[model samples]
Target: MMAIFQPFFNIISETGRVVQFFFQMLDVWKRKSISRDLMFEQIWKVTVQSSATTALAGFFVGAIMTVQFTMEMKDFGALGYLGGLSTSGTIREVGPLLIAFMLAGKVGAFTSAELGTMRVTEQIDAIRCLGADPIQELVLPRFIAIVISSFFLLGLGLLLSIFGGMLLGKYFSGVNYEEYLRHIPTIVSLPSILSGLFKCFVFAVVLAVICTHRGYSTTGGAKGVGRSVVQTAVSTMVAIVIADWATSLLADIALKIFLRSR
Candidate 1:
């Protein structure tokens, strides 16, 4: 009884904390309490660290979706539509969600672990004792970097998914490039593209906040760092899935509205 409600209360408390932290970050940014060098360096580090995994995940996601569609469309003698359908589905939904999951495991875990380590080592405290704001110097840069890097990487993954589907279609499904790409412009609309990008941005923010919050709040030394990493992964993945579902619902509604207006 209490155990069940306890988790709910914990979730609510944690969410409030995350929101407060985000507002603190925004306030810091408004004050220009940011380190340009730290921010750029962190961005470059996260981007480089996550790019390879993102590419591999994105490409394989597109390829796998193509294969599934190929298997289905083949039964109906509809292989020619493989590219457009696969690419459309990947770009509009599968690509962003899967790629974000990958990012959560890779980028989210790493960031949380790194920050947790720093906290456990008293490095954050050392900075604070020196009359420096740790959030501005440490967390802010990471928060901004993760968001930017994630958004860029997610977009890149979506783009690569197109080529991946195209290649798989050619080699595996015997669908030529021309036929595979033919219906994309018609099937994949402006709203679909916008929805995917919007999801990416939302995912980026969620990942950054969850990771940083878990790490920044870590205690109890090394063990706590491990716990923080695990919690961060779970929280980020859950957040990403919820965001995906919400965005998908909103996208559908907006698409209907746009079509009706047209």
Candidate 2:
């Protein structure tokens, strides 16, 4: 039915727009389509304002995983192994995932709603009429900000997660001091860090495309803007999960190739 296919076509059309926007950004990367001031301001907003939430989410995720699993591991008399396992698990999976969810709920929704409101207000069109590429003026800076922010946030989350696992191993898990310390900072590896950052970058791109596309598709008015926010959150999360698994496989392959090359 047309109704079933309508969403599919819209998604495809949006995909095209995202590609076009990406290419346009690439073309203008040197000239810097947008002003430095605007880009930095947006970057600051994404990175700094989001830090508290990121820290809390990352810490709690690590703590909860450690608490939940430490008990299970203890039943098997394997408590000694929990610290490293928990910390590594957090870095390899939890950090990027929670960060993606947080970004979807907070930043992605905000970007969609903001852009949708602008579209409703004809601001985007006005910018176009004034001889500015909306993609460059609006989308490029956001794309740059989010990708950079996600990478930094991924690292931050990893650190906080390790820190949280440390606290739990010491206080909640009944693990010994040397064991706890050794558990955490020990599993740090280049591949895990690189994979996490790479996934974060892909998520950043997914969020940007979903939010901006939904914003541009806004039609009805205030109602449309609200719809876009919801759509952006849902779409971004779905895209992130898919990308997460896919990138993990790609990372494995790439790591293998790198190892062979070396």
Candidate 3:
């Protein structure tokens, strides 16, 4: 029992070290100078590379939501509300959640595997020997990239998902395109957009930091890298779900307080 507990304690300690490293890197912005290149790479990997997956997920989610909601609305003679319902639900919840999940599978795993490989192969050591900061050279670039890419991808995903929902609503629920478009403004307000963007940004940061930390802390060789990759992806997905719920809850509370003050 003591032996088992000892391993758990070590794991916890290592995890704490990883978290500290992430915060320390963020503090000095050590890689600020190379941020642009890293941003571009991250944009390409997290945003462009994951486009197809995000789009497919968004389309399916939108289509399914529209279908189910339309059926229910039709039964209740509220089919006219399909446009507003679809837009509100997708923008407020589904869009960010789905996109984050997709990115976790794609970008998150890739980041961990790449960094883990570098660590195991001694490339990271070589950089350190040259007096280069590994966090600045690797982690910082990927961090900025993911954050920027997440915002753009989430925005694109929202638009595409909303459009997909609208198409289904128009076809199956008999909603007119013009009317749906006009009603969308009512459901998806500025606040909703801001909320979605904010969630995306948070998700990006969390995903990048966790994945990079996992990679950097990896030991052993091939097996270790593989484990880190899987762990990073799994941890990122769990973190995103938790973060999403927390953000929504906080946003709701703030909105309520602001409205009362107004």
The lDDT leader among the candidates is 1
lDDT (Cα, tens digit) per residue for candidate 3, span 37-83:
66687668677888887777777777788898887878788776677
TM-score on alpha carbons, each prediction: 0.94, 0.87, 0.91
C-alpha positional error of residue 82 in candidate 2 after TM-score superposition, expressed in Å: 2.7
RMSD versus native structure for model 2:
2.5
- In order, candidate lDDTs are 0.86, 0.80, 0.80
| Candidate 1 lDDT tens digits, 98-153 | 76787789878988998899999999899999999888888889988887887788
Which regions of candidate 3 are displaced past 4 Å? Answer: 1-15, 30-32
What total of clashing residue pairs does each candidate reach?
0, 0, 0
Cα RMSDs, all models: 1.6, 2.5, 2.3
Supply the TM-score for candidate 2: 0.87
Clashing pairs in 1: none
User: Model 2 over residues 124-144: C-alpha lDDT tens digits?
Assistant: 999989998777788778777
